[model samples]
Target: MELAVDAKPTYEVGARKWLITITVITCAIMELIDTSIVNVAIRQISGNLGATVEETAWVITAYAISNIVIIPLTGFLGDVFGRKNYFTASVILFTVASFMCGFSGSIWTLVAWRFVQGIGGGALLATAQTVLVETFPPEELDKANGIFGAGIVMGPTLGPVLGGYLTDNYSWSWIFYVNIPVGIIAAILSWKFIKGGKKKLSGKIDYWGILALIAGVGSLQMVLEEGERKDWFSSNFIIFFFILAITGIILFIVRELTTKNPVIDLRVLRNRNVAVGSALRFAFGIAIYCSVFLYPVFVQSFLGWNATRTGLLILPSAFLTGMLMGVNGALIKKGISPRILLIFGFGMVITFAYILYRLATPAAGEWEFLWPQLVRGLGFGFIFVPAASLTLAGLKGKDIGQASGLSNMLQLLGGSVGIAALNTYITRRIAAHHADLMSNLSLYSQTSNERMQGIMLQLQANGKTGEQARQMAMGIMNGSLSTQSSILAYSEGFMMIGIICAIILPLVFLAKIKKGEIADIGGAH
Candidate 1:
């Protein structure tokens, strides 16, 4: 995937540069926000569309499968079509799909449109990063990265907040509807401000490689997104896809490496920094996304908090991450070792997970999460800027697109795997804890008998017959047991994330890049 380079280039200056920055970052954030915004609106959407909650989940699954499928292909797409033209078309495509999604009369229709939207959204993210990289000179590359990193951090954080407000006040459709105006403006700005890449593919298109990528990544994403819901390998549907995922991935690796003109250049992983950096990003995705995924659900389901309130509680942490993006970027530009920053960052992530594990009780409130969330923000800020810098630091020109595409794809895949694994773990833990608690509460236990008696007496005093009181007492005991089991399971889940981060933290030492090398790309001042 070699792209031709110009002998001399012109850079956007003054207000023009800032305008381009805002345009690309806003588009990037918009695409990312769509990734999780629908989560909070699932129930409402199901009700409105006359579909079961289980059926409605395909709305999310479809988008994720298509998004990951297209991400690594963006470099090839951009090389064939001009970057600016491809970007504008993607914005327009996303806008149209969102509109169609809002008006869909059936769940499957919405899912179909969402798949289209994911293709566009995936293109927007990878292309936007490449544009930002080329927008500023190497010396100011950190600034461009800081801005893009801020969007990446803040987009998912803000998704639920905006989705909750719109869903609670208006309707579920409004969540998709809100993107129309933003998309229109972004599309116009993209075409006007972004530069065109003149490079075109000189060899035959690798159609076989493209199909293998779709089969491999799309099936794997489906397996991750739907495996637990479908009972994992117990379900024949999941078993088939799991096998396909493995087979397709193996075929893809072989096809890409052996093909003369591969859709995605697998050879870039030969670079040590790029390889280690991609691994770090994969772990970072798990850490960042698992926390975001679990916290709101825990608060809303167990603590009786509303979606909006939970999202609001997370706002401070999101802002802290955004602020830290610039700080970390500047620190890296000033020759601070990325390895040191990475170690400190992973340590904070471990600390955040442990603190949350300790606090994962039914009684924990908003205040308990405040300090820990700030620590998580620090973890994200530190990890993101330096990880991105280190990943692309060793590459220039065509390699930049290839490495960034692969890096982003790995991160998203990591999130998918983390969410699935944690979900399954929590389910199994809940069952185990429930069985242990039940065994101790048998009729032979004096403590269980006394507790049941006390509950029956209380029910009798509240105007229940003897038999009724006994039944009510039994129900109350079971309810308490179930709730306790859930809390314990969630606590274990948090610790699992911490352990994963700790295991991967050692990889930072393996990523070697000189100070200021990230800023020294293409020899531009």
Candidate 2:
């Protein structure tokens, strides 16, 4: 797989430059927001569409699978059709699909449209990042990345908020409808203003590579998304797909390495910075998204917070982190080592994790989560921008698209894998905790006997028969045991995640640190 290095060039400075930046980033954010936006609306959607909760989950799974599968292919698509045309086409596809998704009468129809939306949406992200990279000179890459990074950070954080509000105030369909106008505007701007990143006729398309990608990534994503509900390896569906995922991925890797004119270049991993940086990005994805996955469920499931309240609680901190991404970029350009920034970032994550572990309980209120969420946002701000800088620091012009695509793909998969693993961990831990707590609640303990006697006496005073009151007291104890077990499991999960961060911290020091550059960038034409 050979890279075609285009001569470095720059667009004329002025209104057009900033306009392109705004257009690309808006489209990027819009696509990203859709990724998580549907999460808060699943219950409403299932009820309205007359689908089972299990069936409605296909809407999310379809989008997620198609999105990750197409991400690494965006670079090749851009090279074939030209980035401007490909991007504009993507936006138009997403917009139309969103409209269709809103109006669909059946659950499968909505899921089909969602898959189409994901294809377009996936293209927008890495392609937009590459376009943003080409817009600025190398010296200003930090500022450029700052702008791009902000969108990535805000999109997921804002998704649940926007979705919750729309679903609560109007209807679930409005979530899809909301993207229509933004999509139209972004498509128009991209067609009229975006430039560069086009290539001449290339070798035969890597058809097998593409299929392998779909089979491998699609199957793996399915396994991750549905595994917990289906009981993992115990389910035949999970077992079949797990086998497909491993076999398909093995084939895909081999095909990419051996093919001339590969669908997505595998050779970029040869760069030390790019390789190490990609691993770090995957770790960061788990750290960021697992918390996002854990917090809402833990609060809603155990703490009894509503979806909207949980969304709002996480919002302020997410916004703070978005702003801090820009600052962290500038600091990198000012000679602060990315390694140092990463260490600080991981330290904050560990700190946030520790606090969350200690604070989580069934009786904990919303306010207890505030400062920890804030610190997490701050940590992400420090981590994201600098990591991007280090990843592509060694790549030539032709390699940027491929590197960006691969990096983004890894991040997405990491999040999926992390969410699945964390959930399974909590489930097993909860069972163990329940068993231990059950032992303590037995009549063998003096305190247990006293508590039961008190409950029985209180119930009897409320006019219940003695036997009925005793039975009710036992029920209350069982309920308390279950609740306490769940809370303990979540707390332990948080500490385990923190330990994982601490273990991966050494990778930051191993990443190559390149001095910031100020070279001109070529347009995507």
> Which one is best on lDDT?
1
Model 1 Cα lDDT, one tens digit per residue, 1-525:
444565555667899898898998998899889988999999999999999988999999999999999999987887678788899999999999999999999999999999999999999888888888878877777777788888988888899999989998999999999999999999999999998754755688999899988998999999999998899999999989988999899999999899888898899899998999899999988987788899888888899988898889888988998998899888988899889888998899899999999998988988898888899998888888888888888576678888889998998898899999999999999999999999978899999999999999999999999999999999999999999999899988888888999999888889887866863344210
CA lDDT, candidate 1, residue 485: 93
Off by over 4 Å in 1: 519-525
- Cand. 2 TM to true fold: 0.96
- Residue 16 lDDT in candidate 2: 89
- Which segments of model 2 are wrong by more than 4 Å? 1-8, 517-525
Cα RMSD for predicted model 1: 1.6
lDDT of 2: 0.86
lDDT of 1 at 63: 92
User: Which RMSD values do the candidates have, in order?
Assistant: 1.6, 1.9
TM-score on alpha carbons, each prediction = 0.98, 0.96
- Could you give candidate 2's per-residue lDDT for residues 10-74 as a string of tens digits? 55369988989999899888988998899889999999999999999989999999999999998
Candidate number achieving the greatest TM-score relative to the actual structure: 1
